[model samples]
Target: MLEHRPVVIDRTGADIHDEARRIRAHGPVAPVELPGGVRAWSITGHAAARLALSDHRFSKDPRRHWTAYVDGRIGDDFPLIGWVLMDNLTTTHGADHTRLRRLTAKAFTPRRVAAMRPGIERLVAELLDELAAVPPGRPVDLKAAFAHPLPSRVICDLFGIPPEARARMLRGGETNVDTTLTPEESAANVEQWHREMYEFVESRRRTPGDDLTTDLIAAKEDGSQLSDSELVGTLHLLLATGTEPVMNLITNAVAALLTHPEQLALVRSGEVDLREAVEETLRVQAPVAHLPFRFTTEEVVLGGVTIPRGEPVLINFAGIGRDPALHGADADRFDVARKDKEHLSFGHGIYRCIGAPLAWLETEIALTALFDRFPRLTLAVDEGELEPQATFIMNGRLTLPVLTEPAVVGSPSDVTV
Candidate 1:
């Protein structure tokens, strides 16, 4: 173990980028303390992060590989217990992981995601129409009214969640990523989320629908392909992962474009596509900032530091995205026209996010339609005054207040796509 004291991470989302810079100063593989006093190593360099993510020595299953959790140092009351303990595809290994991923991939096929484009465009149109109705001078929260609902509604519709049940599920997702919650509150939130997922699964099992949930249930009934626990856990994972990160992607992209008027002009003047803006936002303001709990299967040397077996590791997506070595000195700046816009915001290796295609399609459509409709949209407050989301795991604004300039709603012919 390293002799120096571990750097305690900020539970509050504020200063995460600053914190990442501080962690990088400690070295690529730096000792860090998670919320609730859980000790871990954070991978801060782009190459080191890629190695850790793809290396076979690093295992995602905490129940088997995490010494602290196995020996009871991390209890059920730990605020982040739910993240590591879940039995979804994210926490499986080898054959189990392959099997789970194979089963889950059916729902996210290229055809299925492509088919969602028309519906997604319609949803974007409806949202833009609603934003156009807001009084010109009054500030409207685009994050809540636009970003949050688009993905939430898409996921709910994809899973066949009833309109009445969606609000509760969305609230549960908010709780899942909130690292600032108390032990008691976190435990209770986990319990409630599990209960809600169980009910959802049971409801779908009883009344089959033309949705992914129904498809998954059918697989579960065929030759023991999935267990009850796995079924509920998969749904829970899908609902949470499907909504929150995509929500942040849209909001963060809009925030980036609004603050960086030069970048916005690039998109508006046809110098660059909206996709470039989305890619730049993903690089600078990664939606999932710091992912949790990849444990060492054996002693491994990373960045000249020795990590013992069973030690937990965190992949700092935020830090790696802005690494000067990879993205040059201006990595921190948001530039849509940058030649190299590569990022691990959707992750890497076999564990790379499966919903990435859907997320990209949703965000591109959302941004294009948004700019096309409200050509004069501007931030209601100074960029510095916008509040960050309360959790370190999710990089986004709590609210993006914007003046939607209803009078300037542009026609389709004016779109810069």
Candidate 2:
């Protein structure tokens, strides 16, 4: 047999899809190198990714199963250490996973998410009003002005994070997922994040509020439901997941629609709804592109390759989202009306994203209200000029500049869904 070489993934996230294409060419299960010269297997095909995500042999508890991590080869300076070492629902296995997920799900129930729709709609309207006030000729960075803040505000309110500390929380969340950080930067970020999270939890304990943080605090104090460390870790996970992913989803959908005018016309003519557009966007550009560090419990054969026991694996969501075998030859093309709009962007099986319902509601409302307010909105710069976010773990533009033109002449109430 020829010698196996690991494909080194780009840490800067310059062109993740291009990297994904190369990895897929290697096979469904491909050896890959992470930022710290760390070796892992990537699940590059749709079927393979789904199987790996739901397979019992794949353990999310890296502390127990990941040889490098357990043996001290992976350290604090590793760029992805923060993500791989978390104690939240994302990294737990078996009964621990079940318990954490159950507690987290209570805050994201369909009824709770649906109840927030009116508040979300109101927030969207307020944001649109602010965007409308910008001079017609000046280009606006939609990612900054609209996309990022909408989800930030929604999640902060949901968790009852004090307004004074929201900015630090947002910064810490961004730093946690950025793969391009230097060893010093990564270590500092992890330390800062833990400190801030602990402080926030303590504040919640001192003065309970009507929010998810308070509920989680209560569970932590219930003497068996949640440990103190788990409480902080869970909050950290919720803050990170609840903000950045939804921000990217809105920006990606808007970018997709702006680039594909025909698809935009379909939505404008009522031929396709905004929800369909959102789904298509998710299929093409998943928010979390490459989730980190699931290890194998035993030798497992997949796609004609065997991952040895204790070997690490990554779910390549970016590659799987556009897998040609499942999505057909034109998988890359953005089509709002495409049939069989199936995707594992939120994930699969027990690890499915608990905040998915809230994400969907936020995106749908934000998109509808945005298009309604600025019917003639178009990209201020060429699509090629857009810059990808600095992290391989998350997929989004660093900035999306657009011109909001021919503004609708109406009050907030005049804008109808």
Candidate 3:
């Protein structure tokens, strides 16, 4: 066993640029001793990282076997997303990922996501309108008003959560997000989040609705579709994964643009283009800081480091995107105008974020609509003052305060965002 030396995790915030810089100098992949009582091989080089992510020898399946971790068992600590998602998504790799991806593939197509845009636009408009009401000169938490709520609202609509349940589920959204706590505490929170999700799913299952939850219920009619544990993992995954990171997208993009006046001007002029800008933000500032931890199914060698079997590998995709080695000198520079697509912000191969499309849609809608509605929108609080969540899970600003001009309400058009 590695000395498992106590590495202090900077739970106060999740800026990994320094860590990435250090890893870049050291080597592509190295052992990262986490602050908490855990350790794993942290992979950083973009090309090498993707190669590792794509290789099947490294498994996402937690049951592959490993040393017992701090706080809780493997399944409880780093489990799958939630219930309906439990049996199929993420946990099972190989043919199982393929099968589940195939079964639900049609649901997330670009056309479908695009079709949901009007609703997403509506949600953005409503959120921004409320944000505009914050008294001027007072710092309003945009993370609460816009960043966090936008994605949850979109997810709620996707699942067809009713108004009463939607209000209840938003709390579920806040709690389910990933954190830097011990495995036991995180798992307990996860189990509680899962119970809420189960009741929500069960409500839909019993009532028979049109949302994705109902569809999932119908899709797996034979209760056999999801095991007890699988259900908990899947639901937790959606609630946490879906809400937290995108909140950063909104907060980070606003901060990035505001900090760079030239970039903000370009956005205002439409000369720089918002989609490219958003994509650039994604590449430049990754919202999620931790590498997706994969266990070594067998012995593997890289850069003179031989990872023994069953030792967990922590591939830090966050750093892979900004590798000066891969992206060149202009790499670190956040230029929305520069089209850089070789980013590792999303994982390589099959493990890449399945919700990327939805996330992109939400971000694109939020950003574009903001500029379109209030060209004068600017941070109400001092940009440097925002409190970013203290965790490696979904690293992002905890709140964003913005002052905006009143918006002209558009027709109440519902587009099923």
How close is every model to the real structure, measured as TM-score?
0.95, 0.95, 0.84
Worst 10 residues of 2 by lDDT: 408-417
Tens digits of per-residue lDDT for model 1, 54-141: 8889988888889888898889888888787577886887777778888888889999999999999999999888988776666789
Model 3 lDDT tens row, 207-228 = 9876666665555532335444
- What global local distance difference test value does model 3 have? 0.66
Instruction: Quote model 3's TM-score.
Output: 0.84
Q: Worst lDDT window (10 residues) for model 3? A: 77-86
Q: What order do you get sorting by lDDT, best first?
A: 2, 1, 3
RMSD of 3: 6.1
Q: Which ten residues in a row have the lowest lDDT in candidate 1?
A: 408-417
List ranges where model 1 is wrong by over 4 Å: 1-3, 220-224, 406-417
Q: Tell me how many residue pairs clash in candidate 1.
A: 0
> Candidate 2, residue 182: CA error in Å?
0.9
Query: Candidate 1 vs. truth: CA RMSD?
Result: 4.2
What's the lDDT for residue 221 in model 1?
Answer: 24
The predicted structure with the larger lDDT, 1 or 2, is 2
Candidate 1 collision pairs: none
